[model samples]
Target: MPSNDNTPRADRQELAYLPVPFPKAPPKEPRFAALRTWWQEAWEEDGVLRAMWEDVLSAPEDGFRYMAPWLRAVLMVAGVSFIVLMAKAAGEVVLEGLHQLLTAVPKVQVGGDTSSGVFAVVDQPVRTYIAQHSAGLPVAASTVYTLWLLTGITGLVLGYLSRNNGVRAMWAGWGAASVFMVWTATPATSRPIAVGLAVLAWTVLSAFAMRGLTLRRRVGRPARPARVSVKPEIHVHVPAPAPAPVVEQHPHSGCPFRD
Candidate 1:
C-alpha cells in the first residue's frame, strides 16, 4: 500500500460528478411561487371564492334594522287575531252546547198540570241524563259551566290588556277546569270538543305571551342621531359674447366700395 501522505484527498475532487450515494442537491426549495399561481387559477375557474367575497363585502352592518320591527309587528297582529279567533270558536262551539244543556233544565216540568208547578212535572229523561252524567263531574255541571264562563271573561280581559301575567293565570284556571272535566265527567259526546277548546285556548295564550317577550327584545335601544353636512351653492357669471368679429380694414374697405 502507498504511504499515508500519498492518499487521494476526498474534498479536492468535485462531489457532484463523483458517484456519491447521498441525495443530489439537498432538495430544491419547493416551487411555492408556482403553487400560489396554480391556486389562484383554480379559484378563478370555480368563481365560488369571488362570489363569497362579494357577498361578504355587500352584506349590511345592521342586518336586523328593518327585519326586527317588521317581524315584531307581524307577530303582534297575528297573536291578537289568533286570540280573537279562538275566543269566537270557543263561544260558538263549546258555550253553545252548554247553553242548550241549560235550556233543557227549564223545559223540564214536574207534572202535566201547569198549576202542578215546574218541579212537580220535571222531564224524567232530562233529569235522568243529568243524574247519570253530572255525578261523574268533580263539581256540579252548573259549577263547571260557571268556572268556564269565568275563564273566558278573564282571558278576554288579559288579552285586551296584553298582560302576560293575567293571561297565564287564566290559563291555569282553565287547565284545572279541563282536567276536572276529564276526571269526573263520563265521556259525553261533547267531551272531545270541550277538550279541544281548552287546548286551543291554552296554546294561544302561551304563544301570545312568548311573542310579547320576543317583541320587547327585538325593539332594542334607540338609534344615535346622524350628522349631516350641507354644501354652499356656487354661482358662475358668464361674460357676454364678443360683438360679431370686426373685419378691421377689410370691413372699412367693403363699406367704402358700397358707398
Candidate 2:
C-alpha cells in the first residue's frame, strides 16, 4: 500500500512507459492485382471498340440517342434513306446478279425459261425486264469497298512504329484486309455510285475512329509537371543618411535671449 504526503514515506516504484503493439502488416495484395487494376481501369473507359459494342447492345449513359431526339431530324433522314436504298439495292442486286449470272452460265437454267434454276435465282418479270443491259454474276452481293492507299500505308507505318506489339499486329492485319477487300469488290460493284459511297463511308468512319482515339490518348495520359522560372537576384548598396543633431533649449525667468 502507498502512503500520502502527510503520512509515512512509501517505497519507490519504477516508472513504466506504454507498450504499443507494432502496426499489423498491411494486408497482402491479391496475386492478380495487376489484372484487377487493369480491369478496373478498362471497365470505366469509353474505348472505341467498347463504345461500339455498347451502342450495339443499347447499353450506355444514354441508351440510344437516336430514339429520343426532340427534333427527330436524323431519325427521319435515316429512315427515308434506309427505305429508299433498301428498295433500290434489293432489285438492283437481284436483277444485276441474275442478269450477270445468266450471261455467265446460261445452262444453269433448267429449261429455256429462266423461271427455275440449277441454283437459287430470282424468277419472272424481273428476268424479262432486265436481260440485255446486264449479264449474270457469279456472286450475289451489292457490297461497296474502297481503300485509301495513303490511309492504309500511314496506319501500317504508324502501327509498326508504335511501342505496342498488339497495335502493330492489328494495323498490319487491317491494312492487308482492306487492300484485299477493295481489290476484290471494286471490280464486282455493278453501280458507278457504289465506289463513291464506299469512299465517303470509309472516310467518315476513319474520322470517327481517329477522333475517339485522339480523345482517349489525351484523357488517359498523366499530366506533365509545371515548369517554374527562376530569376537572378541583384543586391543594391544604397547607404542610410546620417541623423541630424538635436538642440535643447530652456527658458530662464530673466535670461530668455541667452537660453
Candidate 3:
C-alpha cells in the first residue's frame, strides 16, 4: 500500500487540478431606460416646465408648510366676502321688488266718502312718496354695490401684489363705508338686522386688517436670536484614597509596621 501522507498529497494535487466554476456576473440591473425616456419627454424645454421641475427639485422638505397659515387666511376671507356680497345683492333685489309692489297699489282719496278714515290721510302720501322715490332705491344700492365690488377687486389685487398694507387699509375703509350705507338706507324695522350685519362685517374686516398690520410690523422687526439648548455637566466620582493601611506593632516594641 502507498504511504498515507503520499496518498493524501496525491489527492490534494488532483483536487487542485480540477477546473473551478466561477460565478456568472449578476444580470445587469433591470434598466430604467424607459422611465428615463418618459421623464425626458414630459419635462421638455418650456420655461413653465423648467420652472416646475426646479420648484419640485428645490422645494423644502416640508413642502410649503410655512405658507399653510397664510393660505388658510386667504381662503377664509374669500369665502366670507363671497357670501356677504351675495346676501347683500339678494337683499337689494328683494327690497327693489317690494318697492315695485308698493308703487303698483292704487292711490286712496282722503277726507272724502271713499276715504278709509285717518289712515288714508296719514299713510297715503307717505306710501306715494316712498313709491315714487323708490326708483332711487336701486341707484343708492348700485352705488354702494359698485363701490364695494371695486374695493374688493382692489384689495384682491393688492393682496396678490404683496401690498398687504394697502389691502388692509382698504378693507378698513370699505368696511366702514358699508356700515354707513346700511345705516343710512335700511328702515327702522329692518335697521336692527342691517346694523347687526354691518357691524359684524366691519368687525371682521377690521380685525383681519389689524392682524395684517400686526403681521407686517412683526415682519419689519428684527428676528430674535434662537435659544441654544444647554446640557447638564456630568461629574465623575473618584474613590477616596483607601484609608491608610492599618499598622501593627509588637506588644513590647512600639515600632509600627503595615500588616
Candidate 4:
C-alpha cells in the first residue's frame, strides 16, 4: 500500500532471527587424575594383582592371615615386583642354557642321512606314547619330571587351602601349572610334542596328592560350644516394725482430773 515498500528487499531484512545450538565440549581431566585412573584400570583389567590378592585370601589359615596387616601390604607389593624380575631373568637364563645344551648335544647321523628330531612331532597321541614308553622317557625326563612335580605340589597346596573347592579346583590348578611350564620351557620347538605327555604325568601326580584324607579328618572335629551368662540369685528381707509403742491413759473425774 505504501508504494509496495520496496524497489528491492534488503537481504538482512528478509532473514529470520533464529537461535542455533552448539555442542558442549567435554570436561578436561587433570593429569594426575588421568594417570591414577590408567593405573587402576591396568591393575584390575590385567588381573595380576587381583589373582594374587585372591590367592592370599584363599588361605586365611596360613601365614598370610596372621601376618601383620602392614607387613602383608608390603609383602604383596614386594612379592609382585620380585615375581616380575625373576620371571624375566629366568626366561633369559633358560633360553641361553637351552642354546648351550643343544650345542653340546650332537645330532645323530646314519649313512649320510639326517632324521627328524626325536621330539619334533606335534601329534598329542604320539607324544603321549613316547613320554610314557621307556624309550621316549630318555628324551626329556628332567623336563617331564619338573612339570609333574610343579603341577602336583601346587595343586596339593592350593587344594589344601581351599578344601571347599573340591577336586575340580585342584585339577584346574594342575592344568594351569602345566600350561605355564609348557610355555616357559626353552627349546620350545622340540618341547611342543612332549607338553601333552608332561601334562598327563602332572595330572596323575596331582590326583595322588589331593586325596584329602587329612582334610576329612580336620573337617570332622567338633566345634566349640558358645559361652552363656547366668544371673546370681537375689533375696530381699524387711523386718516388721516393732509393734507401736503401747499407749495407756487413765480417766480423771471431772475438770479437777485435768490437774
Top candidate on TM-score is: 3
Tens-place lDDT digits, model 4, residues 1-259: 3464555556525435677678999998776998787667756945656656665675565687675565588889999999999999999999998777655433422112122453222223232432444244544533544345455566667665565555546566656655554444425575665666656655665565555544544456687887878889888898889876554454663433221
**Highest lDDT against the true fold, candidate:** 3
Q: Lowest-scoring 10 consecutive residues by lDDT in candidate 1?
A: 118-127
Task: For model 2, name the residue pairs that clash.
Answer: 99-135, 99-136, 100-135, 100-136, 100-137, 101-136, 101-137, 102-136
Displacement of the residue 156 alpha carbon in candidate 2, Å: 15
Q: CA lDDT of each candidate?
A: 0.55, 0.48, 0.57, 0.56
Question: What's the best-to-worst order under TM-score?
Answer: 3, 1, 4, 2
Off by over 4 Å in 2: 1-176, 186-192, 212-259
**Candidate 3 local distance difference test against the native:** 0.57
For candidate 2, the per-residue lDDT at 250 reads 54
Q: How does residue 35 of candidate 2 score in lDDT?
A: 82
Question: Per-residue lDDT tens digits of candidate 1, residues 196-219?
Answer: 554565566556543444343456
Candidate 4 clash figure, as a count: 0
Clashing pairs in 3: none
Candidate ordering by lDDT (highest first): 3, 4, 1, 2
